[model samples]
Target: MKEGAKLIHTSRIPVRWGDMDAYGHVNNTVYFRYFEQARCEWIEQMGFPVSPREAAGPVIINASCTFFVPVNYPATLVIRMHAGEPGRSSVMTWYELFVEGQDKLYAEGAAKIVWMDNATGRSVPLPEAIRALFDAAAG
Candidate 1:
């Protein structure tokens, strides 16, 4: 895969009416939600043998997005998900957002994720299965 082309999962999100702020643009917070959708979808695609109950316990250590063109209602938002650089006990999720049917980039960025033992709430090395997910998805 080319740099910035390692898409492990992708989806088109329909712009929601409520995503627009009073200024008639998608609010800054909506970018985070869009990135969340990409990450969740990628996790599901990895077939990690997880149920919703088991998946709820991860931490977002960091996240940010850079905006360019604006997206509006009734439009399709294309989201691409890929793995980022990993450390001893954490990983990053990178997202590239585009306007559907066009190459216009609306925004792009990443979130730092750390896995924790559910009971202890302490950071842990990502499990082997999850590591495989990164090996397959890392750009």
Candidate 2:
């Protein structure tokens, strides 16, 4: 992670009671789903609506998360996402989850998404429109 990482999107998620474990903390596995929720919102904001009928879209090739502090139930999260500069066929996304109105981070993660052609089920170059949207947001 760099100090200059540009956050391109932000989303708010409520921690559900089901998200907690018997230990009274959010389960580690649930962080990935939170990241996915924020990532999908980012994709839609960038004008690429993800849907079953879409011909092309970004697919998560890899995802990982690192928990900082344990979060219990009865919390609201503000998830921030940064979209890295696009490569030929892929882009990296970074995320940070924080308690609403709090500065401390509860979790952070990154995901590598590659453009794919649903019709062919193969990787494809990022469309020019998508690249422009990212560029504009980065600015």
Candidate 3:
């Protein structure tokens, strides 16, 4: 997490057997899924629809992840999400993944999400309610 980033949401997701690859470790792709789940949970908790086809909704324009340690099965992942300053139409969300009861970080990542008009496929300003939540979190 960055210096000014605000903790927004935390999610506990169990590592599934299918999340592993032939290398016996959680696949790199699965890290993004974990990040997505946490972000979605945060959005849902904010009273926004996850995927609103007829209304403006959040959409990720960019995403990336960094693996610090290999994660194995039979562990519950604690993903904590943090929010940077909100822009007119987007916010940068950061994530940290760790095993439950463990202090070591397994992975970290971020995604830049922009509010978009579903019908027009163009960016729109962040909803006032959402922006207010970000403001409060930053405090």
Which candidate wins on lDDT? 3
List residue ranges in candidate 2 displaced over 4 A. Answer: none
lDDT by candidate, in order shown: 0.75, 0.89, 0.93
Instruction: Candidate 1: list runs displaced more than 4 Å.
Output: 1-5, 48-57, 136-139
Off by over 4 Å in 3: none
lDDT of 2 by residue, 7-86 (tens): 87899999999999999999999999999999898788768888858988889899888899998889999999987778
Ranking 1 against 2 by TM-score, winner: 2
Q: On residues 1-139, what C-alpha lDDT tens digit does candidate 1 reach at each position?
A: 1265355678788889999999898998999998887776666666543343563345778998888877788788999876655676787777889888898778988888787666677887876777666676563
User: Between which residue pairs do clashes occur in model 3?
Assistant: none
Question: What's the candidate order when arranged by decreasing lDDT?
Answer: 3, 2, 1
Model 1: lowest-lDDT 10 consecutive positions = 48-57
Per-residue lDDT tens digits for candidate 3, residues 18-128, read 999999999999999999999999998989988776489999999999999999998999999999899999999999999999999999999999999999999999999
lDDT of 3 at 2: 72
Estimate the Cα RMSD of every predicted model relative to the unseen true structure.
Answer: 3.2, 1.4, 0.9
Task: Write the number of the candidate with greater TM-score, choosing between 1 and 3.
Answer: 3
RMSD of 3: 0.9
Quick one: ranking by TM-score, best first? 3, 2, 1
